[model samples]
Target: MKAKARAHANIALIKYWGKSDENLSLPMNSSLSLTLDAFYTETEVEFTNSINEDVFFLNGVEDKNTLSKISKFLDLFRIARNMNERAIIKTINYVPTAAGLASSASGFAALAAATNKASGLDVNSRELSTFARRGSGSATRSIYGGIVEWQKGINDKTSFAVEIDDASWDIGMVVVIVNREEKKMSSREGMKSTILTSPFYKNWPEDSQKDLKEIKIAIKEKDFEKMGYITERNALKMHATMLGANPPIMYFEPKSILVMQIVHELRDKGIPCFFTMDAGPNVKILCRLSQGEMIKNRLMEDFKEYEIIVTGPGPGVEII
Candidate 1:
């Protein structure tokens, strides 16, 4: 059996910071995100008796570092279906690998979709989301398109993503690529450090839940300014908790702060834009579609050396 799938990367408006159950990939708080059309991953899976063990290839090259993790993830599916055959997984990522751009989200989402189809599991989207979560928590939301939310359910059965909006409106994002290098500390390491060492992390779950509720309402009302405000604030709060950690996990580089300042300056000039960051140095600007090019142009004037891409809402994971 063989299958191929594509899944787009997402930027969390309401971030997923900590995990309640690290082994199961259960989140400490619910998160909301917007799937972007610009960056994505495509994966192909083929099960064969010829292969003695699971094999993984990324970007046309054998990836030994990630093969163990991929094999463990595939085991979940094999156990579910009682299949003994190993599979070959080939994946290509359009997004940067580990620059806080949610590559893992799209990567694992595509793998989950392709594996589900190739193995003939034929599980629904909710069930598929749980499988993706075992690979990465954010991958759970990548199972849905446009605006999505991941509920921090107590268990695997209860935790999954639900679409909040189709995002067919004028909402979009401008991504500022400050650094494409793989991060020194991964999302998992950062989350564990923040949750265990940060004194400020105790309030993160409750605060993020409140922001999620408000942003959902803002999205429903089509209030762009309100949505931007909550998105920016929620991201800042997450970083603040990281800063409060014992070692102070700082993801911002010199240019990262510069990009944030530029966004704030543009907002002061009557442009309705807000900036948010993930676990790395890149910054994403939330804005209306009509103003995306204008904002991109303005940022270009200041950051001639950086790559800036504008993208709109993207689709959910699908067999391709």
Candidate 2:
């Protein structure tokens, strides 16, 4: 039996808001993401001579369906590698249960990496990304150790993620978990609705591409201000797609907007910070290392009980 492992979370800079083909996880546009250290998943695969299918675990609890998903991931990986044998996968995520931080990106990324190790499959990041993408939309970004871009491949053959940079910058993510209540709509459903109903879906072609370009330049220059501006606006625009839905739903609660206000007030006090929200109310504030204290102070004033999480760039999957 071989035990292989992987690590880290990948935060989107240029988010994947829509998909041309959901089954292939083909994005409507290219997106960039940062692999972070504060959260991640680990996986191990072994070709059990006696076992028949895959197995999965979170912390220590076993889940059959979850195991099946990992099995799907392994099937893709094995096919990509043209491996002679397939195996069972066992994985665990270290993040808190359903904190909205652990995307399937980390899980599938770790799983693919582990599968490669366990089966002695040698493949490049691009191949790994394509394999991982078959498992989850976001996992492609997790193939690289730092910032990565997942190009919306017209089809599975052309679609894959590529490394953008090492992301060894001073930027940090201040996660504000609002609603402490999870959104009933999963990110996948939100994307479906946006694609089907949002009039702004028309605007994505221009706006999303603009964000991708500016973010790429910002990373090249290692400029926090430029990076923050592009990320915040891109995220806001992504959220706007929800309001354009037929029923016009919103993920933001009153508290979610309040959290953004807290962020702005902090900036007014000369704190260097900008916030971005995903499909839900939780905000991920991008800030500089030196500005982290001031940003936290302002967040404390508004959210006294809520602790602001501090995280930096995290490397991709490797041994624990």
Best by lDDT: 1
Q: Number of clashes in every candidate structure?
A: 0, 2
lDDT of 1 by residue, 1-320 (tens): 89999999999999999999989999999999999999999999999999898889999999989999999999998999999889999999998445778999999999999999999998999889999999999999999999999998989898999999999889999999999888888989999999999999999999999999999999999998999999999999999999999899999899999989999999999999999999999999999978999999998998898889999999999999
- Compared with the true structure, all predictions reach lDDT values of 0.94, 0.77
Q: Per-residue lDDT tens digits of candidate 2, residues 179-238?
A: 566668888888888888888888896689888998899889888788888888888888
TM-score of each model, in listed order: 0.98, 0.92
Off by over 4 Å in 1: 96-98
Best by TM-score: 1
Count backbone overlaps in model 2.
2
